[model samples]
Target: MKPIVTIAETTQPDGTVLALQEHDGRRFLLSDNVQIASPATKVSERELARIACAPFRPIRQPRIWVTGLALGELLEGLAESVPQKRATFYVAEPSDELADWHREFYPEGTFATDKRVFRVHGVDTGALNSLDSPLHGILLHADTAPLHPRGRGFFEDRRWLSVAYDTLQEGGLLAVASSRRVPKMDRNLENAGFEVAYHEIDAIPNARRPKTHHLWLARKGDYTSHAH
Candidate 1:
């Protein structure tokens, strides 16, 4: 069997170690010896982005905000689905080191050099508040959201959800992906004045241990008539 080699590492403020490892040409990030990020889910993450942006296909220059830049899979997906030259993607990632790591190590994708992608080194609420115009979509993955740091997260906070709800255009969407279903999160989205829809996706279609991920699509307006 081949060995997993750690190509790079970063130490968190709380003394946790984050190591970037490669095994058989596949790269992954591990936090304190537990896998935190991997390209294994790239297909699912891309699909999540594609589904999230389905409502904006008819709109010109649709603006999207992504809560995190874990490996840039979501950004790649967005770039693929939204091909308009004027489209914009605002990526909010609190950790600067993560961005640096991607730049230094994972430089294969155009997401790193994509002119439409804007990097915001901060939290989701702050990034959303700083936007001059409302976004067409807000993308977030529950496990990779930048708001979590050993406590209650921005995704879980009602105030933040309200901000997200208000930051979006009338027919905009708030798409959230999670490894498991959390009923409270669904309720929270509904309580935040969004029309919520749930979807179950296969993260890995033919793997030995098939994994399912949940996606919640919340809309700000009565745009269900235009849903794709």
Candidate 2:
């Protein structure tokens, strides 16, 4: 059974009057001062799944890196999209509580017990520099600020793009979802030596009304442009 949730107006430490919500007895972090009663129907997981699996459709199977394993919803979607027996999956989460919650409440046939999957390094996504693996795809769902920022210099750091570039193999794809539209995100990926593509995806149901997300797909080395 789904848990009951409550919404309240609150202020952040930065003095932003954002809407706060609690779901399944846990508080969720959201942007745009918006709130919802249940997390079971949020845009986050849909955004993650679209960004993670949309690029490599023709490939027989692809190895994927899923950063920010919040609630394991993204991982579960990814497992369903890709052939579990043929694909390799890695999920990185920074919070133990989130991982534990996923293990307890999520569906029974989710990505939890898959042998081809590996869960590791519950640290910040920024520390992904140490990750050594040949990846066909990388999905960044932790924070969009590294791609688009309301604050200066928050997304301009080159190391994040560099790490993303270094992690992908030639013809590999990297997709990130931004809360707001960011033209600079395209330029940043290009500056990092990737041919970038951009798309806008519909937000999940019942969380925020008429909200859409910006998705950026950048490819390392050479690839045909699909997003003109």
Candidate 3:
């Protein structure tokens, strides 16, 4: 068998190491020692996207933003859930090389190909601003949970959460996935003015795994003071 090859590597400002590795024909994007994305996590990860995209099904040509491009499983799942030719997904991936690795290893394009996504390269997804049309849904399933060395505080930072809230259309959805439950993040989400629902998922459903996952699905209320 071939060794797991490191396709690209970069050190974050905080001295965190980000590497894209390939093993057994599968690519793994790692934030230090933690597993960010890989084939092993695909099923459960897709399940996360599935749960997030379900409520927004009635929206026509719903626009969605996915913060990370670690693996395209989330996008794949979003594709399955929305299944609309006109649905547009804006994928904000901070690392261009990592995105390249994804294209090289998993094939370029988002959600099965290039049909579903408008890939945003080299942008800090955390600082994303509102769009011309508010997003119908936003899925944040990046490398690590908030406060982790590699998380970049996607959920922990109130600024980011605020931006996420304002970036969404009324009644839009925001879903966050993490390896474990975060009480603080839950509170932060609430403070950011979302009516949140939390769900726990097996990392690999129907298959035993020591790791569990937490998917927080929050909806932006159409009215009644949840606005930022």
**Across residues 132-177, which tens digit of lDDT does each residue of candidate 2 receive?**
7567877765342211224432235576667767777787777776
Which candidate do you rate higher for lDDT, 2 or 3? 3
Kindly provide the TM-score of model 2 when superposed on the true structure, using C-alpha atoms. 0.68
Stretches off by above 4 angstroms in model 2 are 1-44, 58-61, 107-111, 122-129, 142-156, 204-209, 223-228
Badly placed stretches (over 4 Å) of model 1 are: 224-228
Q: Which of candidates 1 and 2 is the stronger one according to lDDT?
A: 1
Number of backbone collisions per candidate, in order? 0, 0, 0
Q: What TM-score do all the candidates reach, one by one?
A: 0.91, 0.68, 0.82
lDDT of 3 by residue, 9-89 (tens): 887666767887888778887878577777766766687779888776766687888767676778778878887778888
Ranking, TM-score, top scorer first: 1, 3, 2
**Superposition error at 209 for model 2 (Å):** 5.5
Model 3 ranges off by over 4 Å: 10-17, 108-112, 122-127, 142-151, 222-228
User: What is each predicted model's overall lDDT from 0 to 1?
Assistant: 0.81, 0.59, 0.72
Worst window of 10 by summed lDDT in candidate 1: 144-153
Model 1 over residues 1-228: C-alpha lDDT tens digits? Answer: 999998888886767677888999888877678765677667767888999988787777898998888777888888888888988898897767888887888676645788888888776566679999888899888766654554655778888899999998887899998777876988999999999999988898888998998899999986655332
Q: After best superposition, candidate 2 residue 188: deviation in angstroms?
A: 1.5
